[model samples]
Target: MSFTGTLDKCKACDKTVYFVDLLSVDGITYHKACFRCSHCKGTLAMSSYSSMDGVLYCKPHFEQLFKESGNFSKNFQTSKIFN
Candidate 1:
């Protein structure tokens, strides 16, 4: 049997994300609503967000948790891949 309607899943909510609700970051994907700051739970957008490893966070929280490094998460890299 072939699999159906269950290819991609959200890293945060662990729910299947349809194309319409999909929000991809780096290589990982999430439901648009599920994509939020890890600490504050604030909403995140494509252009202005930060990440650690594969975890998502708003810029402020990123700096707060990771400290004001000017450029957050060097090892994992920040969310600067938008183009």
Candidate 2:
């Protein structure tokens, strides 16, 4: 998908940052370079991945992110958000 490439609010820096890249995996839209750590909510290292796509995470955040991203909760719970 094509991205407009703009400044987005960083969850860590809490300020507008220019997105330098994009991730296409999650299919969710956010500033390409603005993704936050799925655990501690910090920034993920760009060097951690060979390519930027979908949901990527820093080493420490991957496990939880993986579960959540995969909708592991679907097996045990329900939320109005999904309805």
Which residue runs of candidate 2 sit more than 4 Å off their true CA positions? 1-29, 49-55, 63-83
Model 1: per-residue Cα lDDT over 1-83, one tens digit each: 95467589898888899888888889898999998987678899987797877777787777776554555554434566666
lDDT of 2 by residue, 10-43 (tens): 4433555454544433334345556665435565
User: Where does the lowest 10-residue lDDT sum fall in candidate 2?
Assistant: 71-80
User: lDDT (CA) for every model shown?
Assistant: 0.78, 0.45
- The per-prediction CA RMSD against the true structure, in angstroms, equals 9.5, 9.6
lDDT of 1: 0.78
Each prediction's TM-score versus the true structure: 0.70, 0.30
- In model 1, which residue pairs have backbone atoms overlapping below 3 Å? none
Q: Which candidate is the best by TM-score?
A: 1
Model 1 per-residue lDDT at 68? 47
Give me the displacement of residue 49 in model 2, in angstroms. Answer: 5.7
